[model samples]
Target chain A: MMKILLLLISFPVFAQDFTGCGEYKFKGILKYDEKAPLKMSYLVREGTGSQMTFSLVNKSDVITLAPFIDKPSQFKAKIVKLMDGTKGELRTPMEIGLRFPDPMSASDTGIEKIKSVKCQ
Target chain B: MKATKPFVLPIFLLCLSFSVGHAAEGSKQFYFLGGGGEPEGETTIFDGEVKRVGSFINSSGWNSTVSFNGGHSKTEDLIKSKMGKAKNAGTFSEKNYNDLMNEIIQKLEKGELKSGDQLLISIDTHGAKRSAGKDAEKTHRVALAHSTATELNNLSGARTVDLDKLEKIINLAAEKNVKLGILDFSCYSGNLLNLHNDKVCLISASGPEQYSYATTAVSLGFFTFSYPITFGSKFFDNMKKGKSLEELFIDSRTTGDTPDFPMINTKEGLAINEMMYRFLTPYLNYNYSSTNNFSAGYVRRGDKFEEQVCRMESSHSDFLKLLKQMEEAAAVANESGREEFQNLREALEEYRKYQRGYEETLRQKFDVEKEIKDIFKKQFPNDQKAWEAYAPLDFLSLNLDSSITYYEGLAERDKGKKYFSGMWDSTVAQLKKQKEISEYVKANLSQNGLDKLKAQDEAFAKSGVTYKLSSRISAEAKKVYEALYNKNKSAESNPCRDFVL
Candidate 1:
């Protein structure tokens, strides 16, 4: 019950759909385990975005997001829990921006909008 | 037509001599009105600026407007009362903009304008872009034209200033030892960095390749609402007080209005230009931004990510050849610049290795998507309705909670470990900022009205699926990235790499 309540409390802060199921289900992109090496593990997308049709690699440091297109395109995103339950990736734990295709990001088609979920 | 040719040169000379005859006559500023006109929703801001600026000039005894022509502006009546149109336009065209610029340049060259004299231009029109340089994909350009003769939609007949030509003219004006300031409240205005200099200051509403706009609440250009220097702010008062161009630009950035980042050029902007030119010359379009400290980054796309990478691959190859010629042709002043160049060289050299691997990963992803489609077809190939539902490429549609966890897992490993430090420090800073902002922009702002999705988070977390196919895809991507970077190689391509045959 306490664990469930903790997840419930953390949902708003996490944003993307990161639920605690297995290791594959809990870690955030660019978010490293404090116990892990500084930059030994991260996932890079195979195709255009973090589409379900992807494969995750455990041995890279860069986490590139999807590029923008000509029209009102859509993509899936999720919130991730960081090491220590906060952002501590790439040596800047204080920087909390974790969403993909930033609304503030530039494009010709106005501001690109994104939807995200976080790890519980 | 042929008969009239003999008179053309003499007439041109006569006009040149005639234009040179009129000096600035000790005018303090050359305030001009332009950007032609806008549509119904956007017209109000242009109209408001005209009335306000025109009134300010008229009320002041300086009486220093070059000529105000709103060009079929709804507020034409107000313009006549104050500015006394020198040349009225049914609608402003690119020709009109060019003519105005020509007149200003002619005046500057001949007018004997001295130090502290100003040539001020304000642009509030539709923006467009075109190719730059010998290779179309390698270089890009920004133009603040489309000062139309009619509605913006009737673009075939409209005239807009060519950015290349505008840059040359603006820079020429700068060379006259006169102060030049431009307030371009249009899209792609920031990309016109060639016009940047101490003698000139430009405030663009949006960065390069970005669309600039206002909120649903009103159609005011983002710069209009900005503090201190904006139209709604103390524009006239600030002008009278002699605010420097730099101060006005800084003030504008402090209260950035649109979702798009506004840009101002300083020495830092020169650095930003380097990153934009060197790092971003590969693609025709991508989402990117710059910081006051010269940091800039472009977002990666899943759809055409490969194409952009491929561009960088080929462009990087050509760039190495140019770098090789540098010692013979040119030399960077600082030793550090050389060192930095070496590092960058190493990074570029390493590109094709991972690029080829990324291609493999993409093929695997497509193959997986194809497999999912095939599975659905085999299960219910006869049912057309079912096929339609499964048509979209959502191979494994996990619940919102599951989606979050999976992404987090990927991100957790990402850590943005640098494969090499060949890129500039500012470039690295920008890449980091882009990733952070990308996530931050989504989390803080209101998302696509999906309250329904949030409610599903808790219940859906329990329905996590572990497909064998998904794992296989993950393994493929892992191999590709592992070859490129790890935490251990964190010095950022330190020893430097030069692509040897």
Candidate 2:
């Protein structure tokens, strides 16, 4: 009886479920060297939607997106370069892929929402 | 032979039973490893102003100084005495440190320490970019610091361990089936919680980019001392009798000068103790509270309001009515008669601006949400779902900066959604009149307004929806109205405007 009571009382305090469900979209600047194999960026997405896309834009210059279409989600061409003339793509590890790709896209429309990009 | 056999069998059975029971119960182990040492002879400047400094200097001693007298004789004496004590203290030499760590690993592998057991490893050392060079090499452990998630799992030994040894060690004590909490007072301690786990609860003194300091006046660092002080003796006395981890952490942040100490836990909503929540809620209830301290409070208040006002579908017709009023006001301004027409036009323009501001606010919020999502994706490649539920509203409310007045209109139409309707509705109404919303957006978005607007446009295109407004307007009107409404709504919801109250 004592053991059961203790368990009951301690239940709410200890019980917790940490699982990521639903959908979310997030965004942040790529923090790593653009030329590096992997670039670090932050992103946020919310709601239940069939597609999500991430894009990067430089405050100043415009670069072409033709050379950077390999994995747009992982890496993308900067429309413009910083005043210093350093050119790089926003990229992270490609192994992870789109975290929550729309299941329907694969089965129905065959459209991949995430892609890679490079600047000419 | 018969007599001997009977006794031996009974003993064997009893021994087997004991071993099995022990195995079933699992192991309980807690590990803490952290220290900071700068071998290049660091300087400690003692100001003559504070007594606390005097005590610290006296207790720990300065570079070569023994006492405040600045006498060379005493300095040499103190150094010699301390050196002798240090040698005798048996701090980890290379051989010993490895041996101790290996022994812990061996125990874990042997299942001597089972799952649901506690393991706390704390490091109070300088973080280095690399595990080489002077200060970096002596204070750093390349294997411990750079160990991958797989490596941690291999050494953990138990079927259900409390701590997940991913890129960072997550404290599993607050979660179900485990009772453990780890405190790493180092600069990047918050990174530990970045690992994907809803079960674990983490409290970091500072974010990864920031540094954590321990003042001379306090025996422990700000976070370290605050935990014990706020939670009181109960934490130590029974562990179970103390406030929940969430409560203790909330109190610590609220009471200190800490910035928005990001708390990521799996437990849905504010899992803090009721008493603590009640206590902290009032401090945040005031309109003029500082943004740094009260942002978390607003989040909590918003969450509370959400609970009261259960999710409403598109059926609440009052939302349409309010939108119609605004639309009518716009139309009247477009085609009016006389002298007060200018005043009316200005008000309509203000209202239109408010709408645009609201949309912009949503777009900005989405940007923040996207940034957070990207951060999580980078951090937890394997467990994206853990970050998904972490803050549902952070993403849910991204494009949902609707006027409180609008929400109230919905509440009035549907009584069921009026749980704490009055509170939030009134606050929103006040904000609408005060131009707080517009000011907040201008202040925060001054640096990145254009980029944010473009992102909003892109978000709309990608989502296949041009505007987030009442479904009453035509698709084209909704798009235009959304842009206008967001601008004005942001003006009304500005924190500074609300703070004026």
Candidate 3:
């Protein structure tokens, strides 16, 4: 039992040393379409879990997180609707939140939630 | 019915004939043969004492060991394959050299060359002004004799061979109406640029006097580091545009820090030259293509891509042309009392803003991803989690209330572990304090005051501190306290979450 515990503790250290985890920086335009360009903001956090969120802002729209989680860190929250009903998604290690695009851009789109647990 | 069917058959036949002819016209055959030689030599300075300078010339000589050896084999293989069933030349001996030159002359005289027949030759060997004694002089003397500007010009039927032999070859290719290019991987290869002509293009390895050899592997020759293998695909694709030889060379050499390699066309009244120039200038003017478009003879380095793209755009005279047009239009509008100035200004401003915002969004995203990766390094020092998550993350919620809470929980979970505890505690404490300060300022400081305080605090906290308290209290207590403080402070007077949970 002691040996097993020691192995478990040492596993992360060994794994980290081998992993080439360093920052990668790049710059390129986010093209959604020919027109209707939305200024996009992205934040991705990974630790015990992984979470990704995108915030898109434009004239006449102010969007914030739509779904509230009891534990935001354990999961990710995606802002699905702004003042106008533009859609987006928030992804976490075990769950996913999706929002629908405006009817003008994409009609018949709906919000989707997917649940799965991933161990890193 | 029979007459109508006959007419339809003729129409179909005509269309088929046209399509087949088009396909044949579009097809191109490109052949490339490149060689580089950097002979290690000892130079003796005839000052009272003979100072013998040893073998190393430049980085190109030392770094190109692997590339040179590999390039030689590859070139030999390619040439042999092309010359299959023809007389095989055993080596680069005098007899073989004469045979090869004869073969080229025979091909030219036979009119076997077509408009799209591409011939690429690259030679990156040392050129000696004076012959050295015996052994060292033999191979190096070829540049002075058979490969000299005058010899090549005489062979190619050029009036004057003042330019480098490489330049003369390209000019001959033009006269023969064949697409020709040469990648010269030698020091002073750029000398060919002075002899630019419509039919010829030269891509040099480096600036004049700068050694163009390799430090890592056996240096192949000039243009070995930058040519056909690296940017061959793009070059072939560009050839389909029917660009002049000059245009093609300019575009090829515009990618790196080497001096602008010139492309020249001597043929007058040729539309191909102008077309090639117009098509290739846009690509060559920038160090990087806007679309990560790789060209023949070039590789993209990630660090320099964006800056190169920006520099290319800023250097373009087209933008200035547009500005001049705008100004003229504005002046006319003002004279006519149309007040279109506001409209024009607004339009340009809006366009500029949109471009700026688009670039900013990409920059921010890149920064965020980088930050997240960095944090992962901190959280899972030796773990692959950070690397794996690099491409997937949006922005790191460094300033988010939830982020604070999450880290707090992680700290609690890490209780009883003193390994890196000091580092973790200090980071958490500093972050907590920062949040507290931000909140305090938000409630009390004016915008200007807040900015000043931020600058001062950031300067003071840049290196950060590792708080080592000499107390019996568990490390978890300090972490828990910091987390709670930060969470509450970021929430802006909101009640703290139930810590017991």
By lDDT, the best candidate is 1
> Worst ten-residue run, lDDT, model 3 chain B?
B44-53
Residues B1-501, model 2: lDDT tens digits: 446665898899999999997687433333323222211121111111112222322343221111111113332233334333222212223343355445545545554544555343333332211111222221112112111112111111111111224223232232223433444343333444445344444444433322333322122334312122211111121122223444444334322222112232323212321112222212211111111211112122222434422321121223334445555675776733222323323433333343344344454654554554564565446644323333422222222234343445544754554533443344344434323323333344434644665665454333312112111122222133223323233322221111110
lDDT of 3 by residue, B4-41 (tens): 66589889999999999767652132222222221112
Model 1 agreement with the true structure over B1-501: per-residue lDDT tens digits: 457688899999999887885453334454554433233322333444455556556654342543333434444565666555333432344565567666666777675555445556655544543332233221122222233323111122233344445565466756765556666655555665545655566666555554444221132555333122332223332343334544444333433222233455554444434533344322212212211100112222335556765675777677676544542232543222333344435544443443344345443444444444454455535532322322123212312233334444444444474432222232234334434433432343233212323433332232122112222222222221222222112432210110000
TM-score of each: 0.40, 0.27, 0.26
What's the lDDT for residue B202 in model 2?
44
Ranking of all predicted structures according to lDDT, beginning with the best and ending with the worst: 1, 3, 2
- Considering the two chains of model 1, state its CAPRI-style docking category: incorrect
Off by over 4 Å in 2: A1-120, B1-29, B37-105, B115-117, B126-178, B196-201, B207-213, B217-253, B260-501
TM-score of 2: 0.27
Chain A TM-score for model 3, please? 0.19
Q: What C-alpha RMSD does candidate 1 show over the true interface residues after superposing them?
A: 21.9
Q: Considering every candidate listed, which one attains the maximal TM-score?
A: 1
